[model samples]
Target: MQRSSTEGPSQYPHCLSSGRTQEAHLIRKGEDMENENKKSIKERVALRNSLVKEALAEFLGTFLLILFGVGSVAQTVLSRGSMGDPLTIHIGFTLAVTMAVYVAGGVSGAHINPAVSLAMCVLGRLSLCKFPVYAVCQFLGAFIGAAAVYGLYYDAFLDYTGGVLTVTGPNATAHIFSSYPGKHLSILNGFIDQVIGTGALLLCILAILDNKNKGAPKGIEPLMIGLIIMVIGVSMGLNCGYPVNPARDLGPRLFTAIAGWGTEVFSAGSHWWWIPVAGPLVGGMVGAVIYVLFIELHHVDPQKTPEEENSMKDKYEMIAMS
Candidate 1:
């Protein structure tokens, strides 16, 4: 009938109960601390400023775009057309646009190109005040991206150029970073080429984003936008490599100007630097006009609710009668 002191739980019920209570208390305390830590982290990690977040997204997006594009050009030129080709550059740009959009679309609408941002501002989709911020971030991103490519291909560049950086020679590597008009290309024609290429770009972009019209599906807009770049490259790239994006061209061009190609990058092609910058800006406006006049304005308004349908019935009847 008597039990030993070391009989365990049966001999010391109260002590066992106390131990269990302590263990439960400690577990609950740990859980509470963990929950508090999680809450603190959740609150601290969120970015509250929309403009700053959007600018960062644009910067990253443009950086990726230029990185892949210029990297492809460097590969092709430095390899003596063995590793890649013009088609390879086109595909590189296409994938670059797609990847950049996927990265930045949710935050900043993925306007990796300043021309697109300018077009959005003109169309009232983006505010005028934010245009400069977006443009600055994009240009900075592209400049840094070009620098990265140059750093990556520094040895190849030296071998190809024999340490001589020229803008208009067989060893010219400046075109690897930016667009250059063909030998026979007139500055006027270069301007026209950019205008048409960028014009088509914005027109298709507007169509792709138009929900009222036959827009791209919810998740694949980025890829469609990419194909537009490829289309432009194949059709309009001959003259000036289809530098449809002002930031895309000028950012890398500025980088080349500073990174040993000298001011000749700006002064070459008959001082052709301004064409890519000004041409795309003008082309964006033109494309917006064309889309608004031809496609967006013609979109038929659809009623979303029963009340809306009823309200629009009378208007439809009147239009039908007219």
Candidate 2:
């Protein structure tokens, strides 16, 4: 007897046909979910890796910067015959900051100081969440760098300088390494000088970093930044010690104060202590704001033909796929 098609084999057997189809569909869905999860995990891993790399860059940059700065001061103390010269300190820090920024720019944007980081944050270039981490890393790196300088010149510091770290008389050059005036000046004058000097330095930094204006050649960004620091040091070295960078000033100052300088660290008084920190911070913010207002905000988006836009999209997709 001929059996009906549906009755003989159940047309699509529940277990072997429809059931298998359902199972295959379920498998496909599971695979899609897994792929999405893996993509998310990879993105998170990349982000974390980038952050770690950046933080390390900041630490190393700050370390090198302080090493050069404090090392110069140590040299002055160690050299019995050679007096501490302001010009030497100026040149030393100028070279240090320039080298550090150039070396670390690709990794961490070369923000070796908190003042710069804060300015970037204000300008929306840096995230607020990362500022504290960067600041702490920089401070610790500076402390370690100062220790290295101390070790390098321990004998000289003890014998030639008699372990004294004063900011006056023969050691007046130490102020250039750190921040102090040869003689006490009016607090207001000192504060104003710091503010104006720091402001000018930050302004120069902002100008150099303005990718829109193309103020300098691509490879010359670090050189320009360094030159700006050098000019500030030379022009304002005698006034307020030109601590255009708060971290650069405060970190080494703390080292000097704790290494045995005592309340003499505050010799300029509490009011003066705030000048370096406050001046640079305010100046950086103002500089970034001014840049955003006058330069960055007005950047012209390059006119692109349809082909160019499509080409860009294709390139982006290719990058994503890879």
Q: Top TM-score: which candidate number?
A: 1
Q: Write model 2 residue lDDT over 188-292, tens digit each, in one string.
A: 777777767767877788888776676888878887887887788778767666777777777777777787766566665543666777877887777777767
lDDT score of residue 308 within candidate 1: 82
Off by over 4 Å in 1: 1-7, 13-21, 303-322
The digit string of per-residue lDDT tens for model 1 on 56-142 reads 999999999999988999999999999999999999999999999999999999999888999889889999999999999999999
Number of clashing pairs per prediction, in order: 0, 0
What shift in Å separates residue 315 of candidate 1 from its native position after superposition? 27
Give the C-alpha miss distance for residue 137 in model 2, angstroms: 1.3
- What candidate 2 gets wrong by more than 4 Å, as runs, is 1-48, 77-84, 164-177, 182-184, 267-271, 301-322
Alpha carbon deviation, residue 249, candidate 2 (Å): 1.3
